[model samples]
Target: MSHEHRHQSHPRIVARLKRAEGHLNAVVAMIEAGRPCLDVAQQLQAVESAIRSAKQTLIHDHVDHCLDARNSEAEREELKAITRYL
Candidate 1:
């Protein structure tokens, strides 16, 4: 398939993002429960880390499956853009 077609095809990534959304909601609940600041901070940090890890997994999948499938240098470079979030 063409790069154009695959550029927006992110089913696996959508799943990871959905999971991250659940993680985020849990963190919010922790805050509403009057948890200690340090504990909340830790949970927030874990959520951030989970999000980053999920993003990296999605990026790697895009590079190996989508970008590489199309053999497009541009798409491959776009995959590197995930580093900006780190």
Candidate 2:
């Protein structure tokens, strides 16, 4: 596909990933500081959820833009690959 067909969610996904990175760093810091297990788990969960959301958004963009830019066979295979993520 051409560069013009690139997924539009790139920026949003990057932002979400950065937020998740921050949360993961905080989780590590909490563990190092001997913080409560529950608090650490909560932060870890937040990071996981953020990453998942970003992944879903990315997949949506791929379906909407990337796949549409490809041929039928490629699009079908890409759809299959996308379902594997679920």
Candidate 3:
């Protein structure tokens, strides 16, 4: 799903996402190379963990900035939507 453009994601979150993208690419390469099932499974798990960590970072940032004051019902609902996906 698309997020708001005004919702400025932190630099660290971007970096984490970039790293996760690299991990995903590596997993694709392994699949193409005829890797064993267990090896590929481990790599997949690593990607999942990375994505989860990234999600947490974004959630923390949103809570600290956008939702800190508890104003803006729309923003709070949006943040809730983001959290449910995680």
Compare the candidates by lDDT and give the number of the best one.
2
Model 3 residue 47 CA deviation in Å:
0.7
Cα error of candidate 2 at position 72, Å: 3.4
lDDT per prediction? 0.68, 0.82, 0.79
22-80 in candidate 3: lDDT tens per residue? 98999999999999989989989998998898888777777666656655787777767
The TM-score, computed over Cα atoms with residue i paired to residue i, of candidate 3 is 0.76
Candidate 2 Cα misplacement greater than 4 A, ranges:
1-5, 66-70
Question: What residue runs in model 3 are displaced by over 4 Å at the alpha carbon?
Answer: 1-9
Ranking by lDDT: 2, 3, 1
lDDT of 1 at 76: 58
TM-score of 1: 0.58
lDDT of 1 by residue, 4-79 (tens): 5343436766776777788789878988998898988887787787677767765665566644465567665666
Q: Please write out the lDDT profile of model 2 over residues 6-76, one tens digit for every residue.
A: 56679889999999999999999999999999999999999999999998887877766645544678667
Clashing pairs in 1: none
Which of candidates 1 and 2 reaches a greater lDDT?
Answer: 2
